[model samples]
Each structure stands twice: as C-alpha cells, then as structure tokens.
Target: MGVTIRPQVGALPVRFDEDGILQVLLITSRRSRKWIIPKGNPMKRLAPHHAAAREAFEEAGAIGEIEGRSRGHYRHRKRKARRQFRCRVAVYVMTVERRVERFPERGERAVRWFTVDDARGAIRNRRLRELIARVAADLASSGRPAAGQPA
Candidate 1:
C-alpha cells in the first residue's frame, strides 16, 4: 500500500439555475484534466469548511457560502510527481453566489456548471458522485436551495 497522505478538504459548489433547479460546479484536475470538485490540502489556521471554500475560489473561481458541516468524506489514491499516496477528503457544500473570471489557479483548470445528473456523469470518483446524488435528492425533495438556505 502507498503512504497515507494528509487529509484534504473539498467543496461541492452549487447554485440554483434561473428556473430554480440545482446545478453543480466542477473543475478539471490540473494534470489529469478529469472533472472533479475543487479540493486542496487543509490550512492549519483555517477551519475545514473555510479551507474548502478557499479551494473552490482558487480552483473553480467560485465564491459562495460554505456549510459548516461536511457532506461526507471519500478516500482515493493520488499521484503526485512520481509517487502515489492515499488521501481522505472531507467535502463541504457551498452555495455559490458568483464565479469570477480569474482566480489563483484559473490558468490551470477548466471550470463548468452542470445539472445534477450531468455532474454525476462527469465525475470519475464513484464515492463523490454518489454523495452528490444524495445531496441533490435531499435538496430537491425539500424544496430548499443549496446549503438549506431559503430559495
């Protein structure tokens, strides 16, 4: 088995479309270009959700309100340089207010908004995809906006 790496934080940036349907924002990984949620290493001085929000801004240009509670966590192996390691990432939900044209990592990533089903299809991580599906179902059934905020 590969070495266990430090746990990371991630954000599921979401918003309601003009028609009030929920949409998710996904970004391409810097190297692989695979669709994924915005994520990064946790900052020791920042709370987990805050770190997740920061990653969203840097990776996806997403500015939003992040829920304090995590949606869930998933484990995956990551390849950095010439080594592979396992990492556990806790994901928070962010209700995105807007996206900026530029961010810290804007040049290195591709960002896009997708419908719940389309987002699920685009994501390669099975655990993350399932987590998003559950969250979308809950938000849809409750008739509430992302992060349980008022519509």
Candidate 2:
C-alpha cells in the first residue's frame, strides 16, 4: 500500500456583496510562492471549517462567516523543508465580513484578490484550476463579482 496522506482543510475566502457579486481571495504560498487559497493542516482540536477560517485570519487577516460544508477539495503536492508531501485540501467557502490591515503572517505572503478566472489561471494544479472554474460558474450565475474585481 502507498503511504497515507492526511487531509488538510482550507478556506476559499469570497467577498460577495449585496448584489451577489463574488470575489475570491488568494495568498502566496509561503513555501512555493504560488497563488493559493488560505489553507493549512488541520488544527489540533478545531473543526475543519473553523480551522480553515483561522488560516484565513492568520494568512490574510480575513474575518468572515465560513460555510460548514466544503465547496470542493483538491489534491496537490506541497513542498516542505526538503521533501514533497502529497496532500488533499478540503476547501470551505468563507464569506468575508471584514478585512483587517494586519495579520500574523503579513510579511510571509502576499495576499491578493482575483477574479475566479484569473485565480484559476494563477493556480498551478489542475484540480485547483477546475475547482475555481466550477466555483466561479456557480457564483457568476448569481451575478457574483470576481475575486479581484476592481472597484
């Protein structure tokens, strides 16, 4: 049997305004420097969705109401110290309520909001790309804005 890869929970933070315009938030992976949603390994005692929210807060200073059900999940190879880890990341859809100027890992990563299409392109993993595409399609139907749709 192959090695067992643990599952990690993450947040796909979205900014949905009154008009249902959707926006997605992406942060640079501290290790790979690739565009990705806020995510991390499951916390010690927190629930998956709750942990995902914490990641958003620490990574992007995002405070929001996170959905309990995961919108989707994808598999990716995460690079650690000197090895690659095969991990599955379950993503919750977080509706951002407010954004703070400071975060714990503020300097560790560069956070950016992007249109779902742009986010899809920025992602290196095929599964992640498809996930974002699916998410965008679902949200756009509601007249939701793009993740990084400018004001």
Candidate 3:
C-alpha cells in the first residue's frame, strides 16, 4: 500500500486586550467551516518562530512580536481525499503589534478575536486548545495591559 505523510510545523499568534485579557486570533475556513489559527509550511531554513510570525501575517493580516520561549508542541491530523496524516506543531507565544482589516492576499478567511476561553472552545483541535490556554495563563500572569488598551 502507498503511504502518505503530512509534515508538521509550528505557529503562535496571540490576542491581548488593554485590560490584560489574553485572546487569540482565529480564522474561519470558507469550505471547512473550521475555526483555526494561522499556520503554514515551514520556510526554507527559517526557525519555527519566524515561520509562525510569517504565517500570522499571511493568514490573519497580523503583525506581532513573539514573546518568551516556545510554548510547546501539539499533534494534529490532516485529512486528504481518502486518507489522513498526522502532524506535529510547535506552539509559541506572540504579542500583536498591529492588525490590518484588509489584507492583501488572504481573501478566503474571516478573521476574528476570541477570549482565551472562547478561543479554546472555537478550535476543534484539542492540543492547540491546550496551547492557547497555556499562553493565556502566561499572559494573565505577566501583568501587562491587553493589546490596544490605554494604560
């Protein structure tokens, strides 16, 4: 039997409010109707954090800075026409620097912000939800103002 494989990668884009309520950005897939974070294939010779940043911009029209160390890793399944493949994704924490309502290339997605709890429930992947929870806890304990909030 012919075997199929899916490569794994990493991504982390966080949403923060002025009140320090940590949130995450999720995009709705037009066809799948699944709410998922921004992520893509690894860049050539680029680290996972860098790739994550790039994916955030491409997928969510986001500009952000990665924070702290890598959060951790998670595994996911990719379904194809007739088979499924497993992938492992590394998670990192990021601070949103800017967001543009109109992105140049990503027209297939609808971007929205979700509070930690809502984000956790929106994502179908269990591992990714766990990562979001961990990052939200870290941000809550960091004592920083949420993004776009007046200090």
Best candidate, lDDT: 1
Q: Using Cα atoms with residue i matched to residue i, what is each candidate's TM-score against the true structure?
A: 0.93, 0.87, 0.81
- lDDT scores in order: 0.88, 0.82, 0.71
lDDT (tens digit, per residue) of candidate 2 on 1-151: 8966869998888876565556789999886699988988998899898999999999999997787778789998877778878899998878787889988999999998876777888889898889878877876786653233321
Which ranges of candidate 1 are over 4 A from the true structure? 1-5, 147-151
Arrange candidates, best TM-score first: 1, 2, 3
The TM-score measured for candidate 1 stands at: 0.93
* Runs of candidate 3 exceeding 4 Å displacement: 1-7, 145-151
- Cα lDDT, model 1, residue 1: 62
Which candidate's TM-score is highest?
1
Question: Which candidate do you rate higher for lDDT, 2 or 3?
Answer: 2
The list of candidate 2 runs beyond 4 A from truth reads 17-21, 143-151
Candidate 1 per-residue lDDT over residues 1-151, each given as its tens digit:
6565679999999888989889999999978899999998999999999999999998888997888888798877789889887889998889998999989997898899999999999988899999999889877887754555522
At residue 90, give the lDDT of candidate 1. Answer: 96
Instruction: Pick the winner on TM-score between candidates 2 and 3.
Output: 2
Taking every candidate in turn, the Cα RMSD to the unseen true structure, in Å, is: 2.3, 4.8, 4.5
lDDT of 1: 0.88
